[model samples]
Target chain A: MQKVGILGGGQLGRMLIQAGIDFDLDISVLDPDPNAPCKLFANRFEVGKLTDFDTVYQFGQTVDVLTIEIESVNVDALEKLHQEGKKVFPQPQVIRTIQDKRLQKQFYQTHQIPSPEFVLIDNKGQLADHADFLPAFQKLGKDGYDGRGVQKLTSPNDFEHGFDKPSLLEKLVDIDKEISVIVARNESGGMRTFPVVELVFHPAHNLVDYLLAPAQITPEQAAQAEALAQEVMLKLDMVGLLAIELFLTKEGKILVNEVAPRPHNSGHHTIKANGTSQYEQLWRAILNLPLGDTSAQSLAAMVNVLGASGHTGNAHYEGVNDTLGVKGAYLHLYGKKLTKPSRKMGHVTILDQTLQGLEEKIDLIKRSIKVVSK
Target chain B: MQKVGILGGGQLGRMLIQAGIDFDLDISVLDPDPNAPCKLFANRFEVGKLTDFDTVYQFGQTVDVLTIEIESVNVDALEKLHQEGKKVFPQPQVIRTIQDKRLQKQFYQTHQIPSPEFVLIDNKGQLADHADFLPAFQKLGKDGYDGRGVQKLTSPNDFEHGFDKPSLLEKLVDIDKEISVIVARNESGGMRTFPVVELVFHPAHNLVDYLLAPAQITPEQAAQAEALAQEVMLKLDMVGLLAIELFLTKEGKILVNEVAPRPHNSGHHTIKANGTSQYEQLWRAILNLPLGDTSAQSLAAMVNVLGASGHTGNAHYEGVNDTLGVKGAYLHLYGKKLTKPSRKMGHVTILDQTLQGLEEKIDLIKRSIKVVSK
Candidate 1:
């Protein structure tokens, strides 16, 4: 058995280490937060900043392979490690591109990948020149996650109040529906994809609320989405899991919305529904082992359980027994201590054969459980 | 969330902690082995002998509830804790009775539970006096597992070399098939039982090699097995998981073979084939939560992969890729280092909707994977 180290140790890393238990491999994790969920599972927990060059370099030196759960880690150290003949999945180049919104959009455009039109603003001074694109989105180029770095613009006044950091603005694609595809590629270039998933947003919080695997799209549309995802992963040429978020335009055109190079929120349902979960695929992708089956054995629906409004202490879930009483509901808690409004606390996955029945169960779960302070 | 402490840390404890990840609870383990498989995932790991009174009592005091993964733990410490108003699942008396074969068999007899006729022997010197019990089995009363402390007697010569210790001799039942049913009883006595499973043993190793869930039996026979298991659990009067091993004779008779007060090998298939796994059911039982569904969604087959003959040091599996190539096979590797002949290392689970397909897949897996040293 060999040792592997992950860069950021949050819930994604937590689940990844859980998957690693079935494989006879030694795993370690490094995170700045001593209470990070991965600390409880990984063979070793080194509490240090992920972006510090010395810390990452030292951690990378001790493992046979290195990977990341979050993309905000130090890429320069990763490049140095790769130069010294150490294995790094999704190589440094992939991380560099994904960390910057400007570079990600540019890569898609240069590779003839379909995406919405966008322009980069190096600083707030450059925001005024992009006033022509009034009704667009301003996204920070780096170090942003969840729903944090995105702002909708309607006039020049909104642009004046935008972040001074490097950013990109793009016209919102006229999407009829949002969908995602998770693809796994091994070091040998063996690639497999999960069934496409449909994402429905919560209007009040603007976060993804409902997701359906084996998205209810026509066969032709499913084929088109899978093909686009394949092209994107092949172009990236990274050895790991990639989640491609895409938009189906009202005119029936598919456009790449954004790209993530590690385990993403949309793929969590795979742990319960697919033959090989996205986390396990990432393991195979790194070990260069045979990728297990990526097919979904059943239809699944997912709902994100966020921290309820006006709660800010130790986290406690209410009505868990009631929500669990609903048939076909399974939950995964992150084991985080503090809960703030709209913070990602945990998620519930619902597996059912009928979409209508799954929807009804999802409704029952949403109304029953609430994450709040005791 | 409250913390629960497990007394032993082997593969059973490893699987229990894996199941705990989904629930919002803190878990710890106390095992003497520094390299116990549970050293990583548990919230706390105390490296102390399970039989040492002070060590067990100290560990028990830190958690709200105490349970056991193996029966050899210190029961006196559990009794002391129970007197101190702490919760110990299965209670102290259950472990004490189940630890000794004589007491366990007597418990069954007093409760009118159907079992093979047996007589207790104070020592090996008294073996010959029971000539009427010729052609029977001599089993040591305590501290025996996996084919150890058990002997078959067919003549006077066999009894002459029996163990010189407290033991019991029983009439060997002619078994048509061996089956096991797992029953869970909560604090309020709410109970549930999983479908019966048939176990097949390997001739050369004398160990269970293959298992099939939803055992192929007449509906009437299945009902009888379930009723027997329910009676055994209710008599034990414990709040935890109980696995009852039973034998169906050639004359259509059911006899209780033995009982395990924690998670058992025959229930492992629940991880893949049932709506709720035995590990999860154990948590629900101890926590006094409403029990989850136990219906088998699909027929499942399992094959044990033991260490090959004449192999030791550093475990490495051969042909895992090929075994996993089977359409529905799932592999679970116990992170054990040493490999000895016939030592249980891991298992492969195959799930299918049809019995014919499941049998074929089980055969493919059995011939494909071999556990050995690198």
Candidate 2:
């Protein structure tokens, strides 16, 4: 019966609301967009800047527990609310540490977590001093999201692509595959991890293009990935879902790439493919309830439905009927009204008993669906 | 996208909204209760009487298609809407027949569908003329719902229990097991049926208590049950979800007991246990989209969380946390505010790869959870 509030009512908040409805949870959402996806669905919705101290603090006062779908929220307000006896999941300090790439790297280094080596830089001018760290990626210390604020710097000639403010130069790893492990921790310190998922990124968009659950890896590798994810979550001392992206180096090392403090794209297939979905897990963690089983029900694949190129107007899904025709394909449209090239329109989760079946259907799904504008 | 309007906004409508949200379908609902379950979540909600001619007629004009979660709506309005080109699924005529017990029985007999033998009666005085049909059930011609408006007659002394209006005296079958098969048909004639589910009724309340999917029946029996359900839907010319409740007589004959023209409690487990949920199938059928695969993802059972016998006030769920601790247990609260004795508060679905695991968990769930007034 707890009144829960969420910051940022985009697709993640929308999906969380879908899961929360099952438990009849009283959920409210605050998003700056009056036309947010959760605008029409949330029990109560208030349009306000998530980073405005007064806006967030006032919103926090109306709910028993507060959480976020995005990480760029006003942490100071959350800290004040936490001190005021309201439950703020993922913890204010955890959010603050993750809000900055430099702090996140430092936390990993301080904990001896096997993440990629990194050096903090104050501005683009400092890139020259880190020439020895060439071939690294420069990521903005804050305000970056969904692959937007990181640029590859192979040499001094690429320095112009580096962030001009507080940032970090992260040494690129020789990755064989990119995988993610989603872990959940409750207030009681109960932790659980979903099956490791293999991610395939869009070449140009730097976003997850498609992913396979129970990533093709030896049990030892999976256990190691799960263990590393758990170590990072425990070290952060966070309560809620955490998505840890990792690099499976050619040398067979499981090195941490980055971590998201909430449900991540890697786990979206869980709604249909796992024993419990990440969205449901978030609710359990924030509500201080028992965590759910994270076992995969079957081999599954998720393909993001990005907006079709050259389309930008009222959204009209092409081939949705055909996609629905494919057996085991579950379409989840975010209810967004417009379409712009590469925008996250929705996703489809395909389930099958065999890896071969999954591979074939995923190919068909990728070729058949497009989000265009009318 | 086509707009959809629902006649009622109770649990069934709430669930349909959940499924519809996945497809980003535009949905609206009209229920007399301002606090209807779908009020907070539906794309649009209007507080209007579903049985009011003006309310139902005017409401139907605002959507591309109209449907119902309950059958006691203004069918005359729907009939007019259907004639005027708006899609009224289950068809107004189907609702008309199914709404009256006498008409439903006659339709079955006329279609050569195997069902309980029955004789139409004009009043309670006519019951004495059918002494040979003693121990039969006298169902009122209209307005009978759940277990109400129906009474058992075993002798002349029980004639007082019969309705004074038009009714039917149906010979009760030598019952063994009660089962349901949900069938879906679309505008283009595409049809699909979910696995047969065995139902256990509450002895005191004529409602389904719990059910097991792929009901513990022989393959031949299962097929026969499914075929009978299909026959009923085909005869009714229904386009949408139809829940066919059948009586598996002691002789192993499958006889039609009754039918509901929308999602039923027997198919609730499909939400998590099947490849496609009944709620989703309803949307597919109504939208003229391809029917989804109805294969069971795993062996599953659902137990309704009814309000405790002595409770009647604002509702509070007890032991939800404990019930949640059981692996594979999925809780779905209906969000109803009151706790009346025998009222359906919610349901918990238990899934497992083994039947024994489901049976054991069902017992535990039945014991641990209680919906009470607080």
User: Which lDDT tens digits does candidate 1 get at residues B1-374?
Assistant: 67889999888898898888777668889999987878766779889999988999999999998899999888999999999989999899999999999999999999999999999999989998998888899999998787798989999888778988999999988889999999998887889999999997777997776998999999999999999999988889989999999999999999999999999999988887887789988988898876777888778988877999989877889988788667668788888888888888988888888988987787778888998887
lDDT per residue (tens digit) for residues A12-52 in model 2: 99999989888887889999999888877888999999999
Q: Top TM-score: which candidate number?
A: 2
Q: What stretches of model 2 exceed 4 Å from their correct place?
A: A201-209, B201-209
Tell me the TM-score of each prediction against the true structure: 0.96, 0.98
DockQ of each: 0.58, 0.77
- State the DockQ, from 0 to 1, for candidate 1: 0.58
Residues A127-175 of candidate 1: C-alpha lDDT, one tens digit per residue: 8998888799999998778868999988998866898998899887788
Worst 10 residues of 1 chain B by lDDT: B321-330
